[model samples]
Target: MVAFSTDTSPLPKTKKSLQLGNYGTLMSSQEMPEEYWTPLKLPPEKRVTSSRSDLTSVATDNLSELLDETIAEEQTTIDRVFAFLGFTANPFSSYADDVCNNKASDMRLSMLSNISAAYNAVSISMALDIMQDLYETTSKDKSLCSSALIAGMIVGQLAGGAIGDILGRHMAMAVVMSLQIVGALITACAIQSSFSIYAFIAIWRLILGIGCGGVYPLAATITAESNDDTKDGGKAVALTFSMQGIGYLLPPILTALLARFVPLRLLWRIILGFGAIPGLWLMVLRLKNQIARTNSQVYKSKRNMLTNAREVPVNVLEAIYVEPDLFRKMIGTGGCWFLFDVLFYGNVLFQPIVLSAAFGQAETVQRGAIDSAVVSLLALPGYFASIIAMGHQSPRFIQSQGFLMMAILYGSIGVFFQHLSRHKFALVLLYGGTFFFSNYGPNATTYVLPSLTFSSSCRSTLNGICAACGKAGALIGSMVFVFAASKFGEDIVLLACAVVSLIGMVVTICCVSETVIHDEQIKKPEVRMRVVISEPSLLDYFETA
Candidate 1:
């Protein structure tokens, strides 16, 4: 028979104070408080001598029984807690244990499903073509169309950014997707209506643009925050961005299909009406999966504090300005995007004119063939290269290098285009090179950089501001490209883009830092140093003592 020894011992009390000392300086004993120390009392017991073999067997049996009972109780407690929280206890409940054991295949599948669902609204290029038609029909004036489109872009980005902040990312995305559906319907109806169809289209486009802009920031924020690894976040974001390339590729194919099968006038209406399908589907999925995949955890703590507390909440502008370092970084990074937009959009908009001069303005199927083939082929390489680079390089590096390369390429075009004897193959090579490098650099940079730098809480707003700046740059670029081409020709306009690209390169080099690596350390020592130095009392003491 096994014998049990019953012993009673008092549990030790926790220490009330701790002493900390550096170098030879002695911290006060009173401050440390010796009274906090309570030694554990040993159990008073008389040992009964027994054979070693019997004692070992008895101890092992007792230890196994104790562990078994403890594990059972722990499992019972866990189940109760999970029940209270309304969470289903499944294999996924041990996500961390599974991850550690390299068994996260289900998690991976879930993430992929979420990504596919989120990125279903891939209609950017189709939307652009549809918008062009709306503007042309409504305004009958090219400049007004351009201006309205620019304004719409800016308004959409700013509103989207702000809305994403006020509401959660999921809510913002759902709202925008709903708006997109409405905008599409209104635009389709407005086209057929007799009353100022142009104004109606412009207004609807503005609403559509707002929704589109919101999607970018919200998607980026969600992708970055949801992933377990930063590298995974980058890959997820890159995949979403790759959809823009899909949109770019799809439209030309769509346009070609429409041209071959459908009438040109009906094409715009079909595109506009069809654009809502993806958005509506995404909205439904978002609603259905709201409980499982929402990014509420990211903002919940900050939001709870804001709601429960009496302290005044800082306005967006006030919060930004208060942190001057952050403000400068945002402005500088945003400025690079601004410059990138000018060069990128300017070149894209004026490509027809440049190609017309090189290949001759025939407006024939041959001309269309050459133009489509060249642009499509050039864009394909650039887009794929960007996706590949997203995983391997820092966004800042890609952006800065892209700007510098674009500046050089554009500047060279001015010098080289004049000398080339309008050889079709040679011109294609030059144009393709420009398109390839531009996508590789600025296009990828603009999208990637905004997603990387800002804190999750403020990312949407900052990205919105960056997007607004980008549109402003596009507006400037379009006006300049048109003006310069009219006054001096393509050479002058290309040269101007080169200068803007150079400025963009400079801004990126000076301001942006790599955000791919998670900086576990505080935001930068300089920011804190400046904060301390700026205090009046600190400055006064430094000057005197």
Candidate 2:
């Protein structure tokens, strides 16, 4: 186990290079982001079990000694100042700006990452209405489609996170996007083919889920690294993330519009295939302009494979042993995320049930789609609201406030369920509030925090673990919601959600315990980080020379 340290000395000028402990890198401060020395404010950790992997825990005692010694010798004054200043970033990093000097290229790269961040919601939201055919035809379980997708996401995410750490974020992203497109087309084709369509759909949907889940951690990592420089940077990232609010609305809006003209069966296939568009367009954009590389040395993926492959577990342990309070941070980040998803997905997966309770059955898909769209309208503003709120408020504030508000809303609804039910419009608006607060609160912040908080080498991996916790929550919520509704009615379930949200608020306050109110609010989460080094991040992260 590594001991906690407070050393942050600059590297020796005579010694041109020092091998980063356990990371196997020999980069100097000269190899770091130019802004590392150029007046960019510093940054932001936790612990739990050292075994994040199944591999038997290797002793990190030597690794910890190596870490303390390396940190004492290599960390620059800027890193120390960063820690001293509470790890807050300036409004813009000259280093980040240098990475993509071309305005058009920068915007395209940002947009692509944003699309990646937002599309997971679209993948699932678009298909929910159509997948009902399984239950209708075979008298099978209704949640099969979502469950398959969620399950796929869990597996894909775990694998993708490790892959991102071992390979690179860019490569990992490309592979997942490819999987998403392939999964979409294959699912679409399955319906059109004469084969056992359910089997194919389920299998491909799992594939699609894997793709969707994998991208989320990557998106958050890319966006935060690229944009964590300024308040506007956070705003820009949050705005794109807000697109998820619109993502939830998009499918139903399209369905509402298209269901009038297209056949339901054919329309469903089109919707399934529609998942490919964002990933496809983003891939094309990357291939076209080509993002510039900023590092002095190009990554030799083949040469480093053996080196990086084994480090994933090492980094996971590094986070546990080296980073102060990392265990607690994981608990806070993962726990709050788990709780949020329980409510968020439960509500999302069962929107029809709620609507049916209020307005009777949708009677037709088109009517139901329109109703869904109307409620989702509130969510659009809610997402943008976070962009604005993030510019001024701490994510911790937003997260805690959001959970409390959600609890109040859910409890109020539960207490007066019959009254709200009698007033259908009131119930819909109240329901819509939950979606709004979700995006504005934990939803956006959860995406925001992990990217900015973790060490760059394991950033994607940690984000993956946290995001997987969220999907786990989503899976649990989706699974139990229908059964719980049958047993105790929606009112009891609403009260339970209220309680869960309260637990989330408590998790946010205690687990993510670092609180530093600053202008650059979101960039710093771990102000008291015990172990830090300015190593090259695995993504295309350095400035272009």
Report the number of the highest-lDDT candidate.
2
lDDT of 1 by residue, 412-475 (tens): 7777767654666666666777777777777766766676676544567788888788878887
Query: What is the Å distance of residue 95 in model 1 from its true position?
Result: 11
| Positional deviation of residue 154's Cα in model 1 after best superposition, in angstroms | 0.9
Highest TM-score against the true fold, candidate? 2
lDDT of 2 by residue, 31-134 (tens): 44433222212221122233433111222343345445665676577556433423343222223232333222333443454454344445444455655653
Model 1 clashing residue pairs (backbone) = 138-198, 156-210
Q: What TM-score against the true fold does each predicted structure earn?
A: 0.65, 0.69
Model 2, poorest ten-residue lDDT window? 37-46
Instruction: For candidate 2, give the lDDT of residue 327.
Output: 81
Once fitted onto the true fold, the runs of candidate 2 whose alpha carbons sit more than 4 angstroms away are 1-136, 139-142, 192-195, 290-320, 357-360, 514-545
| C-alpha local distance difference test of each model | 0.54, 0.62
What lDDT, from 0 to 1, does candidate 2 have? 0.62
Number of clashes recorded per candidate: 2, 12
